[model samples]
Target: MKFKFSIIFSFFLYITYGQINVKGKVVSKSNQPLEGAAVFFNSTTIATITDENGEYQLTVPEGKYKLVASYLGFKTVEREVDINENTSLDRLNFTLEEEDSLLNEVVIGAKKKTKSKKPKYEDFLVFKEAFLGRTNYAEKCKIDNQKALKYYFDPATNTFSVEAKEPIIIINRDLGYKITYNLEKFQIKDRIISYFGYSQYEELEGSKRKKKKWKKNRKKAYHGSLRHFLKTFITANTKEEGFDINIMHRVRNEKHPSDSELAFSKKIFEFQDKRSVPINFNKVIVKPESKLDSAILIHQRQLKHPKIIDKLIKRNVSYSDISYRVEGKVYLKFDGFLKVTYNNEPEEFNYKRDIKRRLGVQKSNFLLFDSPQEILPIGQIADQNNRLVEGYWSYELFANALPLNYKPPKE
Candidate 1:
């Protein structure tokens, strides 16, 4: 009798100490078992991952508890249940619904029509018009660069080049010691090609003499900076904000334009300031229409490359019809550039002057010179030969002349 009582007590203690098996299967709304689902009790105490069969088990004290089932891409589900000391739970199950990606859909029961929303003209047009004129100047100029090494194989040779990147913008001209690396400081190579593209203009014959004359008459130069030239050209030619059909896209079976026809067509639509406009136009009529059998997308992606136009030309891109995608971030303005290359090489010396709109002092004003000149002050070199040598640092200029506190021109 004593032995039987001890055995019964031992059995009772074993039953009390044993854990309550909390078993369940987590599944999605589609009734498919979620293999990597997580199951937890009271959000923390007991946690377990679902098996390949979406079944999970957690040994917990026989008490009331909350169970949570979670999986990626699905809404979490929770349940409250009671557990007894000697109870076995039946097939516990969880059903999770896929999380709706668009938040508005959950509250409204359906996605609202986003197509009806007004199109943002500032996203595409304003910057396009502002920078396209630079495209024009670049296309007209003969891009050429010659390395001016005063002495060969000498440390003091003063190696430099002379050329303006496609756009004759002062910022695009680069002349100086091509510092390739720096140990203590982060070495930077001035990248200026961000400004110009294959422009819509003819190469001027006898450009060398013309450039010389322009340099001699710096004060009387028609455009103060390449910026001014481009801004003027873009504003003068483009009356409306629309894609230029000729330069941007190749129309097929369309009304063939006459030789005197304007390549750029003004869109009749007028956009209001701070007001959204609808994007409505045939794809073919879009400024940047993709060619059926071309790599325009590839080229646009690689536009950040220094020699993009050269690469595009190598890939059979037509100089006249190379599409200029006006897609860019908000009004990109560069402080200045250290290097400007044309015809695939760096320029030696160039100079461009910018007037401080408020001060308007012609002399003793900010003279935007090459970075080399900026580092080596020309005034300090007093000797004639030394001054000449220091002054020999020629610079090309690609600048946008703007009045201080410039407001957008009235259309």
Candidate 2:
């Protein structure tokens, strides 16, 4: 089974500058100042905690930003402001109301539920691996809050489902970023995982030496990433950027997917009295092999390596057309997997204790599916219609994500 991410909204982690200034105060609904409130732009490292008087100041580069203010026991607040060379923003105060944090119906036990109504321990383990990830950086990730998650398992169909009542806070010590994630939906069935969520990242404070090391690591993380590939594609620098695309086709499984593979979870009776606890999965029930030829669905099912045809020419691609966004047959979906070859290879160090590896990156090969039409802006590649292949893009998480504004350092 393959697992990958399909980003749906506009999420960015752009770098910030001090050319623009923004100041604000944080207060409660009663007009009482709230000190130590976390405030910052989404995704960027620029952020500040409120002072004793609930006042704060921030100077950033000229750009559009969603300023956020958050405090414990209060609803998070966000305001959008755009800064151009001609103007700057100031005195943007926020009044936060109390927030209601409720666990999912399962956690609060709003209705009667038995042990069988909850997710199995093994299924949950798989969910964690798919969501938090299986990489070294993911290993270093610690979820500050886990109890808020609501889980359910269906054994008859082997489907696991989960959703967070509140945001999931994670500290990525290896990557130097703290992420707050709000999960909207998640499902694991037939060894395949799919999820969509929103998130914000706050850069961790560190010493000068540690910050330097992190800078190197951040650059290393960007290589071969989807964002890296997109920027290069937009600029028509695929060869120089070390990227090659081979359009492969998917051959539909002659035998339609079994009931076990279909996304719908079969119901079960929890008690001897025949109390049926149906798994309430309110999503479109899709066959493991979705039959929409017009809209190609990306799944992680793997068969023996399949055939490849019509390898695209690097010279045929133009600066204006990057394939994923324009909607013709840019990608080929076969019923099976393709034999892939990446022009670039992962980096290998020859010497011990080499920080040089920190300064550079090795390339990785990836296979992902995209929607026939785009759900995001031109810069983003795939939408919900697309499925990420369980390779490089799936492996990389928010820990390594960068914004469209990022530019690789000149070698």
Candidate of highest TM-score: 2
Give the Cα-based TM-score of candidate 2 against the true structure.
Answer: 0.61
RMSD of each: 34.0, 11.7
Per-residue lDDT of candidate 1, residues 177-241 (tens digit): 01110011110012111221111111123456665543443322222222232232223321122
| Candidate 1 global TM-score | 0.23
Give the residue spans of candidate 1 off by over 4 A.
Answer: 1-18, 104-411
Tens-digit lDDT track of model 2 for 184-298 = 6676666666776545667789999878877777677676666666555445566676765543444445344334433322211123126553332332335533332111122
**Model 1 residue 176 distance off true place after TM-score fit, in angstroms:** 58
Worst 10 residues of 1 by lDDT: 1-10
User: Residue 64 deviation, candidate 1, in Å?
Assistant: 0.4
> Clashes in candidate 1: how many?
24
